[model samples]
Target: MAGKQVMLVGVDDSERSFYALQWTLDHFFHSPSASPFKLVVVHAKSIPISAISLGGPGAVDILSLVEKDLKSTAERVTEKTKEACKKKGVEVEVDVTEGDARNVMCDAVEKHHASVLVLGSHGYGVFKRAVLGSVSDYCSHHAHCSVMIVKKPMAKN
Candidate 1:
Protein backbone atom coordinates (compact mmCIF):
# COMPACT_ATOMS: atom_id res chain seq x y z
CA MET A 1 0.00 0.00 0.00
CA ALA A 2 2.84 2.38 -0.79
CA GLY A 3 0.49 4.86 -2.37
CA LYS A 4 -2.53 4.18 -0.16
CA GLN A 5 -3.69 6.96 2.08
CA VAL A 6 -4.13 6.39 5.81
CA MET A 7 -4.62 9.43 8.03
CA LEU A 8 -6.56 12.65 8.46
CA VAL A 9 -5.38 15.42 10.72
CA GLY A 10 -8.05 17.74 12.14
CA VAL A 11 -7.05 21.24 13.11
CA ASP A 12 -8.86 24.05 14.89
CA ASP A 13 -7.38 27.47 15.67
CA SER A 14 -6.32 26.12 19.04
CA GLU A 15 -2.65 25.93 20.03
CA ARG A 16 -3.07 22.28 20.86
CA SER A 17 -3.82 21.61 17.22
CA PHE A 18 -0.51 23.12 16.16
CA TYR A 19 1.33 20.65 18.31
CA ALA A 20 -0.73 17.80 16.97
CA LEU A 21 -0.02 18.86 13.39
CA GLN A 22 3.67 19.02 14.11
CA TRP A 23 3.65 15.62 15.73
CA THR A 24 1.85 14.02 12.82
CA LEU A 25 4.27 15.36 10.21
CA ASP A 26 7.30 14.40 12.25
CA HIS A 27 6.22 10.88 13.02
CA PHE A 28 4.29 9.82 9.94
CA PHE A 29 6.08 11.47 7.05
CA HIS A 30 9.51 10.14 7.89
CA SER A 31 9.05 6.94 5.94
CA PRO A 32 10.03 7.67 2.36
CA SER A 33 8.20 4.67 0.99
CA ALA A 34 5.05 5.02 3.03
CA SER A 35 1.78 5.68 1.28
CA PRO A 36 1.27 9.23 0.13
CA PHE A 37 -1.21 10.07 2.86
CA LYS A 38 -3.22 13.25 2.86
CA LEU A 39 -3.53 15.82 5.60
CA VAL A 40 -6.88 17.56 5.88
CA VAL A 41 -6.73 20.55 8.18
CA VAL A 42 -10.20 21.80 8.99
CA HIS A 43 -11.49 24.83 10.86
CA ALA A 44 -15.16 24.60 11.69
CA LYS A 45 -16.35 28.00 12.92
CA SER A 46 -19.92 28.71 13.88
CA ILE A 47 -21.41 31.72 12.15
CA PRO A 48 -23.31 33.72 14.68
CA ILE A 49 -26.74 34.73 13.42
CA SER A 50 -26.44 38.04 15.18
CA ALA A 51 -23.28 38.95 13.29
CA ILE A 52 -24.83 38.04 9.99
CA SER A 53 -28.07 39.84 10.69
CA LEU A 54 -26.30 43.16 11.00
CA GLY A 55 -26.22 43.50 7.19
CA GLY A 56 -29.91 42.89 6.55
CA PRO A 57 -33.16 41.30 7.67
CA GLY A 58 -33.37 38.36 5.32
CA ALA A 59 -32.06 34.80 5.19
CA VAL A 60 -30.30 35.45 1.90
CA ASP A 61 -28.04 38.13 3.31
CA ILE A 62 -27.38 36.15 6.43
CA LEU A 63 -26.40 33.15 4.41
CA SER A 64 -24.06 35.32 2.37
CA LEU A 65 -22.27 36.38 5.51
CA VAL A 66 -22.00 32.81 6.73
CA GLU A 67 -20.54 31.75 3.41
CA LYS A 68 -18.01 34.53 3.48
CA ASP A 69 -16.86 33.66 6.96
CA LEU A 70 -16.60 30.01 6.10
CA LYS A 71 -14.46 30.74 3.09
CA SER A 72 -12.20 33.06 5.00
CA THR A 73 -11.68 30.61 7.83
CA ALA A 74 -10.98 27.86 5.37
CA GLU A 75 -8.39 29.96 3.57
CA ARG A 76 -6.62 30.85 6.79
CA VAL A 77 -6.47 27.27 7.94
CA THR A 78 -5.27 26.09 4.58
CA GLU A 79 -2.48 28.65 4.54
CA LYS A 80 -1.35 27.61 7.98
CA THR A 81 -1.47 23.98 7.04
CA LYS A 82 0.53 24.64 3.90
CA GLU A 83 3.19 26.44 5.88
CA ALA A 84 3.36 23.61 8.36
CA CYS A 85 3.69 21.05 5.64
CA LYS A 86 6.43 23.06 3.95
CA LYS A 87 8.39 23.27 7.18
CA LYS A 88 8.20 19.51 7.56
CA GLY A 89 9.15 18.86 3.92
CA VAL A 90 5.94 16.93 3.35
CA GLU A 91 3.22 17.41 0.80
CA VAL A 92 -0.42 17.29 1.87
CA GLU A 93 -3.80 18.22 0.47
CA VAL A 94 -6.13 20.28 2.67
CA ASP A 95 -9.91 20.24 2.92
CA VAL A 96 -11.86 22.83 4.88
CA THR A 97 -15.55 22.42 5.57
CA GLU A 98 -18.02 24.44 7.58
CA GLY A 99 -20.39 22.93 10.14
CA ASP A 100 -20.35 21.65 13.68
CA ALA A 101 -16.72 20.63 14.28
CA ARG A 102 -17.45 17.13 15.49
CA ASN A 103 -19.80 16.45 12.63
CA VAL A 104 -17.57 17.97 9.98
CA MET A 105 -14.51 16.15 11.23
CA CYS A 106 -16.20 12.77 11.21
CA ASP A 107 -17.64 13.40 7.79
CA ALA A 108 -14.30 14.44 6.38
CA VAL A 109 -12.64 11.28 7.67
CA GLU A 110 -15.25 9.11 5.98
CA LYS A 111 -15.15 11.07 2.76
CA HIS A 112 -11.39 10.84 2.60
CA HIS A 113 -11.39 7.13 3.45
CA ALA A 114 -8.97 7.84 6.25
CA SER A 115 -7.61 4.97 8.29
CA VAL A 116 -6.81 7.17 11.30
CA LEU A 117 -7.76 10.57 12.70
CA VAL A 118 -5.18 12.70 14.46
CA LEU A 119 -6.14 15.46 16.88
CA GLY A 120 -4.88 17.34 19.88
CA SER A 121 -6.04 16.67 23.39
CA HIS A 122 -7.25 19.86 24.99
CA GLY A 123 -6.11 19.71 28.56
CA TYR A 124 -9.46 20.49 30.02
CA GLY A 125 -9.76 19.75 33.67
CA VAL A 126 -11.99 16.84 34.54
CA PHE A 127 -14.77 19.13 35.60
CA LYS A 128 -14.66 21.21 32.42
CA ARG A 129 -14.56 18.18 30.14
CA ALA A 130 -17.41 16.59 32.02
CA VAL A 131 -19.47 19.73 31.80
CA LEU A 132 -18.70 20.66 28.20
CA GLY A 133 -18.12 17.32 26.49
CA SER A 134 -14.73 17.86 24.91
CA VAL A 135 -14.34 17.64 21.12
CA SER A 136 -11.56 15.05 21.42
CA ASP A 137 -13.84 12.89 23.48
CA TYR A 138 -16.63 13.20 20.96
CA CYS A 139 -14.32 12.22 18.08
CA SER A 140 -12.84 9.36 20.08
CA HIS A 141 -16.20 7.72 20.45
CA HIS A 142 -17.70 8.79 17.15
CA ALA A 143 -15.05 8.75 14.42
CA HIS A 144 -15.15 5.81 11.99
CA CYS A 145 -11.37 5.52 11.93
CA SER A 146 -8.88 5.08 14.73
CA VAL A 147 -8.21 8.32 16.64
CA MET A 148 -4.88 9.56 17.93
CA ILE A 149 -5.03 12.24 20.62
CA VAL A 150 -1.73 14.11 20.88
CA LYS A 151 -1.26 15.78 24.23
CA LYS A 152 1.04 18.75 24.66
CA PRO A 153 3.80 18.09 27.12
CA MET A 154 3.66 20.27 30.20
CA ALA A 155 6.46 22.81 30.26
CA LYS A 156 9.01 22.11 32.94
CA ASN A 157 10.52 24.93 34.91
Candidate 2:
Protein backbone atom coordinates (compact mmCIF):
# COMPACT_ATOMS: atom_id res chain seq x y z
CA MET A 1 0.00 0.00 0.00
CA ALA A 2 2.72 2.44 0.98
CA GLY A 3 4.75 1.66 -2.11
CA LYS A 4 1.94 2.26 -4.59
CA GLN A 5 1.98 5.53 -6.49
CA VAL A 6 -1.21 7.56 -6.34
CA MET A 7 -3.39 7.90 -9.44
CA LEU A 8 -5.97 10.68 -9.38
CA VAL A 9 -8.93 10.99 -11.72
CA GLY A 10 -11.19 14.01 -12.15
CA VAL A 11 -14.85 13.32 -12.70
CA ASP A 12 -18.15 15.19 -13.20
CA ASP A 13 -21.76 14.50 -14.09
CA SER A 14 -20.89 13.99 -17.75
CA GLU A 15 -20.95 10.64 -19.50
CA ARG A 16 -17.43 11.30 -20.77
CA SER A 17 -16.09 11.46 -17.23
CA PHE A 18 -17.65 8.11 -16.34
CA TYR A 19 -16.31 6.63 -19.54
CA ALA A 20 -12.81 7.77 -18.66
CA LEU A 21 -13.04 6.25 -15.18
CA GLN A 22 -14.27 2.97 -16.57
CA TRP A 23 -11.59 2.93 -19.23
CA THR A 24 -8.89 3.45 -16.65
CA LEU A 25 -10.26 0.66 -14.49
CA ASP A 26 -10.46 -1.72 -17.42
CA HIS A 27 -6.97 -1.05 -18.68
CA PHE A 28 -4.90 -0.38 -15.60
CA PHE A 29 -6.55 -2.43 -12.86
CA HIS A 30 -7.20 -5.59 -14.78
CA SER A 31 -3.97 -7.27 -13.77
CA PRO A 32 -4.23 -10.42 -11.67
CA SER A 33 -2.34 -9.05 -8.73
CA ALA A 34 -3.23 -5.90 -6.83
CA SER A 35 -3.48 -2.82 -9.05
CA PRO A 36 -0.27 -0.94 -9.51
CA PHE A 37 -1.54 2.39 -8.25
CA LYS A 38 -3.78 3.73 -5.53
CA LEU A 39 -6.84 5.42 -7.06
CA VAL A 40 -8.57 8.63 -6.07
CA VAL A 41 -11.52 10.28 -7.79
CA VAL A 42 -12.45 13.92 -7.45
CA HIS A 43 -15.67 15.66 -8.40
CA ALA A 44 -15.64 19.43 -8.67
CA LYS A 45 -18.94 21.04 -7.84
CA SER A 46 -19.37 24.46 -9.42
CA ILE A 47 -20.28 27.36 -7.20
CA PRO A 48 -23.30 29.40 -8.25
CA ILE A 49 -21.52 32.52 -9.43
CA SER A 50 -24.57 33.72 -11.29
CA ALA A 51 -26.61 33.84 -8.13
CA ILE A 52 -23.96 35.80 -6.27
CA SER A 53 -23.43 38.18 -9.15
CA LEU A 54 -27.09 38.87 -9.57
CA GLY A 55 -27.32 40.80 -6.31
CA GLY A 56 -30.95 41.36 -7.16
CA PRO A 57 -34.20 40.61 -5.37
CA GLY A 58 -34.27 37.03 -4.07
CA ALA A 59 -30.64 36.57 -4.99
CA VAL A 60 -29.83 35.08 -1.58
CA ASP A 61 -32.77 32.74 -1.86
CA ILE A 62 -31.66 31.59 -5.28
CA LEU A 63 -28.18 31.05 -3.95
CA SER A 64 -29.46 28.60 -1.34
CA LEU A 65 -31.39 26.68 -3.93
CA VAL A 66 -28.41 26.55 -6.21
CA GLU A 67 -26.22 25.32 -3.41
CA LYS A 68 -28.71 22.61 -2.61
CA ASP A 69 -28.70 21.52 -6.22
CA LEU A 70 -24.94 21.46 -6.29
CA LYS A 71 -24.83 19.28 -3.16
CA SER A 72 -27.38 16.90 -4.62
CA THR A 73 -25.47 16.62 -7.85
CA ALA A 74 -22.26 15.95 -5.97
CA GLU A 75 -23.91 13.15 -4.04
CA ARG A 76 -25.15 11.59 -7.23
CA VAL A 77 -21.79 11.84 -8.96
CA THR A 78 -19.94 10.30 -6.05
CA GLU A 79 -22.44 7.47 -5.78
CA LYS A 80 -21.97 6.57 -9.41
CA THR A 81 -18.21 6.73 -9.00
CA LYS A 82 -18.37 4.32 -6.06
CA GLU A 83 -20.39 1.90 -8.11
CA ALA A 84 -17.92 2.06 -10.95
CA CYS A 85 -15.04 1.29 -8.64
CA LYS A 86 -17.02 -1.47 -7.03
CA LYS A 87 -17.26 -3.17 -10.41
CA LYS A 88 -13.49 -3.60 -10.52
CA GLY A 89 -13.35 -4.56 -6.84
CA VAL A 90 -11.04 -1.61 -6.45
CA GLU A 91 -10.91 0.61 -3.41
CA VAL A 92 -11.24 4.29 -4.29
CA GLU A 93 -11.13 7.53 -2.36
CA VAL A 94 -13.72 10.10 -3.46
CA ASP A 95 -13.58 13.85 -2.94
CA VAL A 96 -16.08 16.58 -3.71
CA THR A 97 -14.95 20.19 -3.79
CA GLU A 98 -16.54 23.50 -4.73
CA GLY A 99 -14.70 25.38 -7.49
CA ASP A 100 -13.80 25.35 -11.18
CA ALA A 101 -12.93 21.80 -12.21
CA ARG A 102 -9.56 22.65 -13.70
CA ASN A 103 -8.27 24.25 -10.55
CA VAL A 104 -9.81 21.60 -8.36
CA MET A 105 -8.23 18.80 -10.35
CA CYS A 106 -4.78 20.36 -10.32
CA ASP A 107 -5.06 20.96 -6.61
CA ALA A 108 -5.97 17.31 -6.07
CA VAL A 109 -2.91 16.15 -7.97
CA GLU A 110 -0.71 18.35 -5.84
CA LYS A 111 -2.38 17.30 -2.60
CA HIS A 112 -2.28 13.60 -3.38
CA HIS A 113 1.19 13.68 -4.90
CA ALA A 114 -0.27 11.70 -7.72
CA SER A 115 1.97 10.17 -10.37
CA VAL A 116 -0.72 10.56 -13.02
CA LEU A 117 -3.98 12.47 -13.44
CA VAL A 118 -6.70 10.91 -15.60
CA LEU A 119 -9.48 12.80 -17.33
CA GLY A 120 -12.11 12.42 -20.03
CA SER A 121 -11.90 14.21 -23.36
CA HIS A 122 -15.05 15.79 -24.67
CA GLY A 123 -13.37 16.00 -28.09
CA TYR A 124 -14.57 19.54 -28.59
CA GLY A 125 -13.45 21.17 -31.79
CA VAL A 126 -10.97 24.02 -31.68
CA PHE A 127 -13.64 26.70 -31.64
CA LYS A 128 -15.84 25.02 -29.07
CA ARG A 129 -12.87 24.05 -26.95
CA ALA A 130 -11.68 27.63 -26.91
CA VAL A 131 -15.11 28.92 -25.98
CA LEU A 132 -15.95 26.27 -23.39
CA GLY A 133 -12.47 26.13 -21.91
CA SER A 134 -11.35 22.50 -21.90
CA VAL A 135 -10.60 21.21 -18.39
CA SER A 136 -8.43 18.35 -19.68
CA ASP A 137 -6.40 20.72 -21.79
CA TYR A 138 -5.78 23.05 -18.88
CA CYS A 139 -4.85 20.23 -16.50
CA SER A 140 -2.47 18.61 -18.96
CA HIS A 141 -0.37 21.74 -19.07
CA HIS A 142 -0.74 22.96 -15.51
CA ALA A 143 -0.95 19.84 -13.37
CA HIS A 144 2.19 18.72 -11.58
CA CYS A 145 1.67 15.09 -12.62
CA SER A 146 1.41 13.27 -15.90
CA VAL A 147 -2.07 13.44 -17.46
CA MET A 148 -3.91 10.71 -19.34
CA ILE A 149 -6.95 11.78 -21.33
CA VAL A 150 -9.32 8.95 -22.20
CA LYS A 151 -11.35 9.68 -25.27
CA LYS A 152 -14.45 7.57 -25.71
CA PRO A 153 -14.93 6.04 -29.13
CA MET A 154 -17.54 7.90 -31.07
CA ALA A 155 -20.67 5.95 -31.79
CA LYS A 156 -21.46 5.43 -35.44
CA ASN A 157 -24.91 5.98 -36.75
Candidate 3:
Protein backbone atom coordinates (compact mmCIF):
# COMPACT_ATOMS: atom_id res chain seq x y z
CA MET A 1 0.00 0.00 0.00
CA ALA A 2 1.16 3.53 -0.63
CA GLY A 3 2.31 5.35 2.45
CA LYS A 4 -0.02 7.93 3.87
CA GLN A 5 -0.57 10.56 1.22
CA VAL A 6 -0.57 13.57 3.49
CA MET A 7 -0.41 14.65 7.13
CA LEU A 8 -1.82 17.95 8.37
CA VAL A 9 -0.41 19.60 11.45
CA GLY A 10 -2.39 22.42 13.08
CA VAL A 11 -0.30 25.13 14.70
CA ASP A 12 -1.12 28.29 16.70
CA ASP A 13 2.37 29.41 17.69
CA SER A 14 1.90 27.67 21.01
CA GLU A 15 4.44 25.48 22.71
CA ARG A 16 2.10 22.53 22.53
CA SER A 17 1.77 22.95 18.78
CA PHE A 18 5.51 23.08 18.34
CA TYR A 19 5.94 19.87 20.26
CA ALA A 20 3.22 18.21 18.25
CA LEU A 21 4.91 19.17 15.00
CA GLN A 22 8.22 17.81 16.19
CA TRP A 23 6.63 14.60 17.39
CA THR A 24 4.83 14.04 14.13
CA LEU A 25 7.98 14.64 12.10
CA ASP A 26 10.05 12.31 14.28
CA HIS A 27 7.55 9.48 14.37
CA PHE A 28 6.40 9.49 10.77
CA PHE A 29 8.72 11.31 8.41
CA HIS A 30 11.97 10.17 9.98
CA SER A 31 11.40 6.51 9.31
CA PRO A 32 13.08 4.80 6.36
CA SER A 33 10.65 3.43 3.77
CA ALA A 34 7.96 5.51 5.35
CA SER A 35 5.17 6.27 2.98
CA PRO A 36 6.00 9.39 0.98
CA PHE A 37 3.88 11.95 2.79
CA LYS A 38 3.16 15.59 2.23
CA LEU A 39 3.32 17.63 5.41
CA VAL A 40 1.21 20.77 5.87
CA VAL A 41 1.31 23.12 8.83
CA VAL A 42 -1.80 25.28 9.10
CA HIS A 43 -2.46 28.37 11.17
CA ALA A 44 -6.13 29.31 11.26
CA LYS A 45 -7.21 32.74 12.45
CA SER A 46 -10.31 34.89 12.73
CA ILE A 47 -10.22 38.66 12.86
CA PRO A 48 -13.49 39.98 14.17
CA ILE A 49 -12.51 43.50 13.22
CA SER A 50 -12.65 42.56 9.59
CA ALA A 51 -15.97 40.83 9.88
CA ILE A 52 -17.84 43.29 12.06
CA SER A 53 -16.85 46.68 10.69
CA LEU A 54 -18.06 46.41 7.13
CA GLY A 55 -20.36 49.45 7.04
CA GLY A 56 -18.33 52.11 8.84
CA PRO A 57 -16.67 54.99 6.96
CA GLY A 58 -13.18 53.59 7.31
CA ALA A 59 -14.33 50.02 7.40
CA VAL A 60 -12.54 49.03 4.23
CA ASP A 61 -9.28 50.50 5.39
CA ILE A 62 -9.59 48.91 8.83
CA LEU A 63 -10.44 45.58 7.30
CA SER A 64 -7.41 45.79 5.11
CA LEU A 65 -5.21 46.47 8.09
CA VAL A 66 -6.70 43.57 9.98
CA GLU A 67 -6.11 41.25 7.08
CA LYS A 68 -2.53 42.44 6.79
CA ASP A 69 -1.88 41.71 10.45
CA LEU A 70 -3.48 38.32 10.31
CA LYS A 71 -1.54 37.35 7.23
CA SER A 72 1.66 38.57 8.80
CA THR A 73 1.13 36.43 11.87
CA ALA A 74 0.40 33.41 9.76
CA GLU A 75 3.50 33.97 7.67
CA ARG A 76 5.65 34.16 10.77
CA VAL A 77 4.22 30.93 12.07
CA THR A 78 4.77 29.23 8.74
CA GLU A 79 8.34 30.42 8.63
CA LYS A 80 9.03 29.02 12.06
CA THR A 81 7.58 25.67 11.08
CA LYS A 82 9.50 25.66 7.84
CA GLU A 83 12.75 26.28 9.66
CA ALA A 84 12.04 23.41 11.99
CA CYS A 85 11.21 21.12 9.09
CA LYS A 86 14.50 22.05 7.45
CA LYS A 87 16.41 21.21 10.61
CA LYS A 88 14.72 17.81 10.69
CA GLY A 89 15.21 17.19 6.96
CA VAL A 90 11.47 16.90 6.41
CA GLU A 91 9.78 18.64 3.52
CA VAL A 92 6.43 20.33 4.14
CA GLU A 93 3.93 22.80 2.72
CA VAL A 94 2.46 25.57 4.87
CA ASP A 95 -0.99 27.14 4.80
CA VAL A 96 -2.51 30.09 6.59
CA THR A 97 -6.26 30.52 6.40
CA GLU A 98 -8.63 32.95 8.07
CA GLY A 99 -11.42 31.09 9.86
CA ASP A 100 -12.20 29.01 12.87
CA ALA A 101 -9.33 26.64 13.64
CA ARG A 102 -11.53 23.56 13.70
CA ASN A 103 -13.12 24.37 10.38
CA VAL A 104 -9.84 25.34 8.78
CA MET A 105 -8.20 22.12 9.89
CA CYS A 106 -11.03 19.94 8.66
CA ASP A 107 -11.13 21.78 5.37
CA ALA A 108 -7.40 21.39 4.90
CA VAL A 109 -7.66 17.68 5.56
CA GLU A 110 -10.01 17.33 2.63
CA LYS A 111 -8.41 19.96 0.40
CA HIS A 112 -4.92 18.57 0.87
CA HIS A 113 -5.94 14.92 0.67
CA ALA A 114 -4.49 14.35 4.07
CA SER A 115 -4.66 10.91 5.61
CA VAL A 116 -4.02 12.10 9.13
CA LEU A 117 -4.57 15.18 11.29
CA VAL A 118 -2.16 16.00 14.05
CA LEU A 119 -2.80 18.64 16.72
CA GLY A 120 -1.80 19.58 20.21
CA SER A 121 -4.02 19.07 23.20
CA HIS A 122 -4.54 22.43 24.87
CA GLY A 123 -4.94 20.59 28.16
CA TYR A 124 -7.70 22.80 29.38
CA GLY A 125 -9.32 21.49 32.51
CA VAL A 126 -12.74 19.93 32.14
CA PHE A 127 -14.68 22.96 33.24
CA LYS A 128 -12.76 25.36 31.02
CA ARG A 129 -12.99 23.06 28.04
CA ALA A 130 -16.70 22.66 28.51
CA VAL A 131 -17.14 26.42 28.54
CA LEU A 132 -14.63 27.33 25.82
CA GLY A 133 -14.75 24.30 23.51
CA SER A 134 -11.29 23.03 22.74
CA VAL A 135 -10.11 22.93 19.13
CA SER A 136 -8.46 19.56 19.50
CA ASP A 137 -11.63 18.22 20.98
CA TYR A 138 -13.63 19.47 18.05
CA CYS A 139 -11.16 18.08 15.51
CA SER A 140 -10.97 14.74 17.25
CA HIS A 141 -14.71 14.33 16.99
CA HIS A 142 -15.18 15.80 13.53
CA ALA A 143 -12.09 15.16 11.42
CA HIS A 144 -12.52 12.76 8.50
CA CYS A 145 -9.14 11.03 8.77
CA SER A 146 -7.19 9.52 11.61
CA VAL A 147 -6.44 12.17 14.25
CA MET A 148 -3.60 12.33 16.71
CA ILE A 149 -3.47 14.68 19.69
CA VAL A 150 -0.04 15.41 21.10
CA LYS A 151 -0.42 16.25 24.78
CA LYS A 152 2.03 18.28 26.78
CA PRO A 153 3.29 16.74 29.97
CA MET A 154 2.33 18.36 33.21
CA ALA A 155 5.03 20.37 34.85
CA LYS A 156 7.05 18.71 37.60
CA ASN A 157 9.12 20.09 40.41
Candidate 4:
Protein backbone atom coordinates (compact mmCIF):
# COMPACT_ATOMS: atom_id res chain seq x y z
CA MET A 1 0.00 0.00 0.00
CA ALA A 2 1.18 3.52 -0.79
CA GLY A 3 0.86 6.68 1.27
CA LYS A 4 -1.35 9.60 0.31
CA GLN A 5 0.04 11.77 -2.46
CA VAL A 6 0.18 15.51 -2.06
CA MET A 7 -0.85 18.06 -4.70
CA LEU A 8 0.29 21.66 -4.25
CA VAL A 9 -1.39 24.53 -6.09
CA GLY A 10 -0.39 28.19 -6.16
CA VAL A 11 -3.40 30.44 -5.65
CA ASP A 12 -4.11 34.15 -6.13
CA ASP A 13 -7.10 36.44 -6.55
CA SER A 14 -7.09 36.17 -10.33
CA GLU A 15 -9.59 34.62 -12.73
CA ARG A 16 -6.78 32.56 -14.25
CA SER A 17 -5.88 31.13 -10.84
CA PHE A 18 -9.47 30.18 -10.01
CA TYR A 19 -9.81 28.49 -13.35
CA ALA A 20 -6.70 26.50 -12.62
CA LEU A 21 -8.05 25.49 -9.23
CA GLN A 22 -11.24 24.23 -10.79
CA TRP A 23 -9.33 22.41 -13.48
CA THR A 24 -7.17 20.74 -10.90
CA LEU A 25 -10.18 19.51 -8.96
CA ASP A 26 -11.84 18.22 -12.09
CA HIS A 27 -8.74 16.64 -13.58
CA PHE A 28 -7.06 15.15 -10.54
CA PHE A 29 -9.08 15.25 -7.37
CA HIS A 30 -12.28 13.92 -8.91
CA SER A 31 -11.00 10.51 -9.77
CA PRO A 32 -11.42 7.55 -7.42
CA SER A 33 -7.88 6.43 -8.04
CA ALA A 34 -6.63 9.75 -6.75
CA SER A 35 -7.79 8.89 -3.22
CA PRO A 36 -5.42 8.97 -0.31
CA PHE A 37 -4.38 12.38 -1.54
CA LYS A 38 -3.90 15.76 0.04
CA LEU A 39 -4.32 19.10 -1.70
CA VAL A 40 -2.46 22.21 -0.54
CA VAL A 41 -3.32 25.72 -1.76
CA VAL A 42 -0.62 28.31 -1.16
CA HIS A 43 -0.46 32.11 -1.52
CA ALA A 44 2.86 33.91 -1.33
CA LYS A 45 3.26 37.49 -0.11
CA SER A 46 6.31 39.04 -1.71
CA ILE A 47 5.93 42.51 -0.27
CA PRO A 48 8.84 44.84 -1.02
CA ILE A 49 8.73 46.60 2.35
CA SER A 50 12.51 46.48 2.73
CA ALA A 51 12.88 48.88 -0.18
CA ILE A 52 10.17 51.14 1.23
CA SER A 53 11.88 51.31 4.63
CA LEU A 54 14.99 52.96 3.14
CA GLY A 55 13.21 56.35 2.90
CA GLY A 56 13.08 57.21 6.69
CA PRO A 57 10.40 57.69 9.40
CA GLY A 58 7.45 58.45 7.12
CA ALA A 59 8.43 55.53 4.92
CA VAL A 60 8.49 53.18 7.89
CA ASP A 61 4.87 53.97 8.68
CA ILE A 62 3.93 53.45 5.04
CA LEU A 63 5.77 50.17 4.98
CA SER A 64 3.85 48.89 7.98
CA LEU A 65 0.55 49.87 6.36
CA VAL A 66 1.49 48.15 3.13
CA GLU A 67 2.50 44.99 4.92
CA LYS A 68 -0.78 44.92 6.81
CA ASP A 69 -2.77 45.28 3.60
CA LEU A 70 -0.80 42.57 1.87
CA LYS A 71 -1.27 40.15 4.77
CA SER A 72 -5.01 40.80 4.80
CA THR A 73 -5.26 40.13 1.09
CA ALA A 74 -3.26 36.94 1.40
CA GLU A 75 -5.59 35.63 4.10
CA ARG A 76 -8.66 36.43 2.01
CA VAL A 77 -7.31 34.64 -1.04
CA THR A 78 -6.41 31.57 1.00
CA GLU A 79 -9.92 31.44 2.45
CA LYS A 80 -11.43 31.77 -1.00
CA THR A 81 -9.37 28.88 -2.28
CA LYS A 82 -10.37 26.71 0.68
CA GLU A 83 -14.06 27.46 0.18
CA ALA A 84 -13.91 26.69 -3.51
CA CYS A 85 -12.21 23.38 -2.90
CA LYS A 86 -14.64 22.45 -0.18
CA LYS A 87 -17.57 22.99 -2.52
CA LYS A 88 -15.98 20.59 -4.98
CA GLY A 89 -15.92 17.86 -2.30
CA VAL A 90 -12.15 18.09 -2.06
CA GLU A 91 -10.33 18.71 1.18
CA VAL A 92 -7.38 21.06 1.18
CA GLU A 93 -4.97 22.85 3.49
CA VAL A 94 -4.06 26.49 2.92
CA ASP A 95 -0.64 28.04 3.40
CA VAL A 96 0.27 31.73 3.33
CA THR A 97 3.99 32.39 3.04
CA GLU A 98 6.21 35.44 2.72
CA GLY A 99 8.59 35.10 -0.21
CA ASP A 100 8.82 35.02 -3.99
CA ALA A 101 6.09 32.89 -5.55
CA ARG A 102 8.47 30.56 -7.33
CA ASN A 103 10.64 29.84 -4.33
CA VAL A 104 7.70 29.61 -1.98
CA MET A 105 5.91 27.12 -4.20
CA CYS A 106 9.00 25.03 -4.78
CA ASP A 107 9.70 24.96 -1.06
CA ALA A 108 6.12 23.88 -0.43
CA VAL A 109 6.44 21.03 -2.90
CA GLU A 110 9.40 19.74 -0.97
CA LYS A 111 7.90 20.41 2.44
CA HIS A 112 4.59 18.78 1.57
CA HIS A 113 6.13 15.97 -0.45
CA ALA A 114 3.89 16.88 -3.34
CA SER A 115 3.50 14.50 -6.21
CA VAL A 116 2.41 17.32 -8.52
CA LEU A 117 2.61 21.10 -8.39
CA VAL A 118 -0.23 22.93 -10.14
CA LEU A 119 -0.73 26.58 -11.06
CA GLY A 120 -2.11 28.87 -13.78
CA SER A 121 -0.52 31.02 -16.43
CA HIS A 122 -1.76 34.50 -17.29
CA GLY A 123 -1.19 33.87 -21.02
CA TYR A 124 1.38 36.58 -21.31
CA GLY A 125 3.35 36.94 -24.50
CA VAL A 126 7.09 36.39 -24.73
CA PHE A 127 7.86 40.05 -24.08
CA LYS A 128 5.48 40.37 -21.17
CA ARG A 129 6.68 37.11 -19.64
CA ALA A 130 10.25 38.24 -19.97
CA VAL A 131 9.51 41.57 -18.29
CA LEU A 132 7.22 40.28 -15.55
CA GLY A 133 8.96 36.99 -14.92
CA SER A 134 6.32 34.27 -15.00
CA VAL A 135 5.83 32.37 -11.72
CA SER A 136 4.47 29.31 -13.52
CA ASP A 137 7.48 29.26 -15.80
CA TYR A 138 9.83 29.45 -12.89
CA CYS A 139 8.03 26.76 -10.88
CA SER A 140 7.78 24.42 -13.85
CA HIS A 141 11.54 24.39 -14.13
CA HIS A 142 12.28 24.42 -10.41
CA ALA A 143 9.68 22.32 -8.56
CA HIS A 144 10.80 18.99 -7.18
CA CYS A 145 7.70 17.25 -8.52
CA SER A 146 5.90 17.17 -11.85
CA VAL A 147 4.28 20.48 -12.79
CA MET A 148 0.90 21.34 -14.33
CA ILE A 149 0.25 24.82 -15.69
CA VAL A 150 -3.47 25.13 -16.32
CA LYS A 151 -4.68 27.82 -18.70
CA LYS A 152 -8.04 29.55 -18.51
CA PRO A 153 -10.51 27.78 -20.73
CA MET A 154 -12.13 29.83 -23.48
CA ALA A 155 -15.89 30.26 -23.38
CA LYS A 156 -17.77 28.45 -26.10
CA ASN A 157 -20.52 29.99 -28.18
- Clashing residue pairs in all predictions, respectively, total 0, 0, 0, 0
Model 1, clash count? 0
Cα lDDT tens digits, model 1, 1-157, are 4457768888887789989998888888876346477566656665566655565457676787777876776778778889988877776777767677888888888888888899898899999999976878899999998999999999999
Tens-digit lDDT string for candidate 3 (27-129): 8878524646778888897666645548968877777887787778788888889998998777788888878998999999889888889999888999999
Worst 10 residues of 1 by lDDT: 47-56
Candidate 4, 24-141: lDDT as tens digits: 8887778635566678898888776575857766887778778888888887898889788877778778988898888999999989899998999899999999999999999989
lDDT of 2: 0.93
Report the error of model 2 at residue 154, Å: 0.7
For model 4, where is the 10-residue window of minimal lDDT?
Answer: 28-37
Best by lDDT: 2
- Cα RMSD, each candidate: 3.2, 1.1, 2.6, 2.3
Q: What TM-score would you give candidate 4 relative to the actual structure?
A: 0.89
The list of candidate 1 runs beyond 4 A from truth reads 1-3, 32-36, 49-71
Q: Tell me model 1's lDDT, rounded to 2 decimals.
A: 0.80
TM-score against native, each model: 0.80, 0.96, 0.84, 0.89
Model 2 residue 46 distance off true place after TM-score fit, in angstroms: 0.6
Error of 3 at 120 (Å): 0.5
Better lDDT candidate (1, 3): 3
lDDT: worst 10-residue window of model 2: 27-36
